[model samples]
Target: MEKLINEIDSIVMETQQITKQFQKGDEVEVTSHKLGFVGSYYEATIVSIEDANHYRVKYKTLLTDDQSAPLEELVPIGHVRPVSSHQLGTTSENRFRQYDKVDVFSSDGWWFGFISGIIEENYYVHFPTTGQEVAYPSHALRFHQEWSNDDWEA
Candidate 1:
């Protein structure tokens, strides 16, 4: 819905603030109780920042220890908050950033997609879950403080 996208846009703006409070390689812990399905707890590395509202969080599955099995999480700036100031014996200053790739899902909560490219006013996505190439007009997608990064691998 248009309203949803607008709301998400507003929240995404905070990524800049969160980034300013943190930085790459900073050990971070995320509380998941209030978010999407992955919402329970998340511990990851601030691998990269794409912008002020998005982040490339590199972390492993909590239940798995396979180093090769790594997931780069795209968390909104507003969704990630400081739970611990000290991560791995260091303090982090939010850097307000994002990643080129962000996980996206459909409005029905039944789709998972990855942003493959970013343009001036839109992005192209290859949704593995549905095997569909979808284009988003930036204004069509909605984001919540809690977001779902699940999609079928296309």
Candidate 2:
């Protein structure tokens, strides 16, 4: 059992490292740093690559002040991640493991983070935007996914 778990972990790590660079028209999720939206990732399409470390994305949900068009902005590449292929499901504490990307319910919205450690019935999640580690009960955590092509894939 232990060996099998190790093998699975290896596969997961390799898959994560295999993510390639983003290109135009690629659907993705971008972390928002705006007030009241920090730590939240929003659906977006890569409209253009500004450079090696920046992308001009048009948000699917966010809109302009006049609400006439979708909001577009330049986002740092590090703040973007490929849309997750896992869907949110019933909370199962045992299903979580170290290094797994997850979202935690907080401040009225789901905040993107990763499982840094597990302690008994609690998970220590690290939020990259805040550089903070927080403990959350399993019930408040879920696998991160993005809504794409009229369905949830991550």
Per-residue accuracy of model 1 over 63-151 as CA lDDT, tens digit each: 33554556677777555544332212112352111222233434412222445566655667654334467776644332213222321
lDDT per residue as tens, model 2, 57-113: 998877889989999999877667676565453444538888776888675346877
Best by lDDT: 2
lDDT of each: 0.45, 0.70
Least well predicted 10-residue stretch by lDDT in candidate 2: 10-19
| After superposition, candidate 1 runs with Cα above 4 Å error | 1-20, 31-39, 62-68, 83-154
Question: Candidate 2: what lDDT?
Answer: 0.70
